[model samples]
Target: MGRAGDVAVGVVFGGSRVDDGQIAARQFLLELWHRDQQRLARVLLFHRLPITLEEMALQISMARRSRLAFLSALIACWFGASAFTYQLALPGRKLVFPTDHYSHPDFKTEWWYYTGHLTSASGKPYGYQVTFFRFGLRDKQDVKSQPLFTDLYMAHFALSDIAAKKFTFRERIQRGIGDKAGAATDRYLVWNENWRVSGAGNDHRIVVSDRGTALDLNLKSRKAPALHGDNGHSQKGEGEGRASYYYSLTRLQTDGELTVAGKTEKVSGLSWMDHEFGSNQLRDDQVGWDWFSLQLDNNSEVMLYMMRRKDGSIDLHSSGTLIDKNGATKHLTKQDYRIEVRERWKSPKSGAHYPIKWRVAIPSESVELEITPAFAEQELITNRSTRVTYWEGAVQVAGTARGAPIKGKGYVEMTGYAGKLNI
Candidate 1:
């Protein structure tokens, strides 16, 4: 992709060389041209040449150029790679009330991801996950098409239905770098023709569907936004830049219809949302993670996460929060939580082991909860866009808090264990 984008960037550069001294074009368009050429020059230029130790210094000095004037050339080198597809960058320190919210672009990747718990009118439980991801290709030169309306968006929508002691999962992928297919501007909604998740004010709507399974739903949020880490400075690892602007709508009131096996039924349940975007989302040594969002009987919500590293150690930055039924939030650190796997179930389809039973303990308040899947076959298979498989389902909750029978409903995300997440 870099070679292709470089060829395109090169042509723009060639054209700019012809009009070299035109001040009006040089200041704006020519600069955009130079910035883009410098980006492509980093990769394509070095590939065809040999650099001496002194040339290395010159290459390092490229950062003195405007393209990377904001950050160091060494660090900016990674951002210039082919990994960048599309980008929206903003500079700031903290999130303002209601303003620092919503999707952020400057970060490497951002997604409006939704996975939920549902029950059909016939009393059958179901699960669904629909995600829209945004990636930053920092340099304007990363544009693959001068056609402006070219495709720049990617989406994945999936559905899982559990009934009659069986489960079914379906997924769809969307590629619409077009303005109409996946247009995003002014904080309004955007989608690839159909699979959509967007909002204006307090009302939001999302829809993802196909023949075997579908989601035609309306979600009205009750709880306000909950920021993760220090005002959206959620860290991914010990590294300085390995963090993201992350937050979640712990609980959203869901009333919608789901279709399974050519049958559509009206359903209502609780949905959870996570919105995060950053550059280089994962750490080099981080293996995968187990994330859970449980709504307790006490109207409190507990979100726990454990980042598995290659050395089998847990990353301390892998922590979540406690949101009361009233929507107030309390942050949780390394000392307050523990997740113990009691039994493992291997997916017959993917041949991966997933801990079916978990003993979740939060030592801060001396609480222990046992999470059992509503059924053993809650595993999901995506035929559309995910290009991956995992288990996402409703679970029966049983636990004791202060020796009282406490019941809760929640969702758990088991990744990396199945296979390293593509992201």
Candidate 2:
């Protein structure tokens, strides 16, 4: 199948010295069409390509009647390819608040992620994660008359019952059909069915319920959104469009009701929220990444991601950010920090070996930390929704900052361990 896709792409570009934009557009179109030809044709075409049928037929040598049919099909494919170009993530994009928080339909992919630690009045410890993802199925112009097939929405809800040594999760996926599932461009509202995250002016609410478990949380941001890597342009690999407009609300005061097994409890804790959008962020050689979001007891935070390649080496584009107690942020290059794996765990279901413990150090900041998962089995096999298997879990942190003893809690996400990630 992949060989066939390569051949199709080559045929499309064989006649012309196509530039980067044209190559990307044709490749994307071919991928969608190859995946589902019937659905792609119906959902992705509203306008025709500007080429004339007579001119197209003139370029080919065939019988008069057969020439017309061939040209018609060729034109349809070209129109579909040319009309579905998405805006790339590039430098110099000035990200604004509240507005940037909304959905970006021009980009190919976008996600809003939240993770935190909560404690009940009785001192019971818990952890939670909620993430909403939007994947563009067609360009904005092509979807004006057919809004339902414009995008795909997915959501994931997870709870870590630390005391019980149990982890539970649910996932939902839906198309942009009517009000059943959608993300608002005019506000910070995104939903897949009843699971949703909505906000206004830095105050947000998250709600999700399924299989006798639910979470209803209200979050208030304590600091401004921290822009990452060159003012929100986070480069993932070497290239013009291999980056993302990324930012994080590292600290949020969270209070909410968590219900598990028909028992509801009021909880309070600190949370971290990340919002990122991009067209093409990963290269073909890149496999996946290890992402960390740490909120320390000193009211400071750190975010780091290490992109791993197929050759078992870390990509030079891997980087991080440090948010000080005052919410000021500093970007860290690949050389600014070091991470060493300390332990590994093998998942019984997926048979994927994962790094579950690590030692992280930032020498310039006089910081060093040892991170370990609260429990080892917080992996999710989401066959029902995104169909991606990964481990995302709450972790415990203990270390030294500026020669002082400090402890913290955070979340770690490791992907592509089960298999090569398609995105």
lDDT value, residue 86 of candidate 1: 38
lDDT of each: 0.62, 0.82
Clashes of each: 18, 0
Tens digits of per-residue lDDT, candidate 2, 96-214, equal: 99899988887989999999999987889999999998877555343112222456777899999999989999988765533456777667888877888989977899999998899
Model 1 compared with the native: what TM-score? Answer: 0.73
Q: Which candidate leads in lDDT?
A: 2
The regions of model 2 sitting more than 4 angstroms off are 1-81, 139-148
As a TM-score, model 2 comes out at 0.81
User: Candidate 1's residue-wise lDDT over 282-388, tens digit each?
Assistant: 77788777888787778677888888888878988888888877887788887778888999888887788888889988877778999987666766655334444
Instruction: Return the TM-score for each candidate structure.
Output: 0.73, 0.81
Give me the candidate number with maximum TM-score: 2
Off by over 4 Å in 1: 1-92, 96-102, 137-152, 380-389
Model 2 lDDT-worst window of ten:
1-10
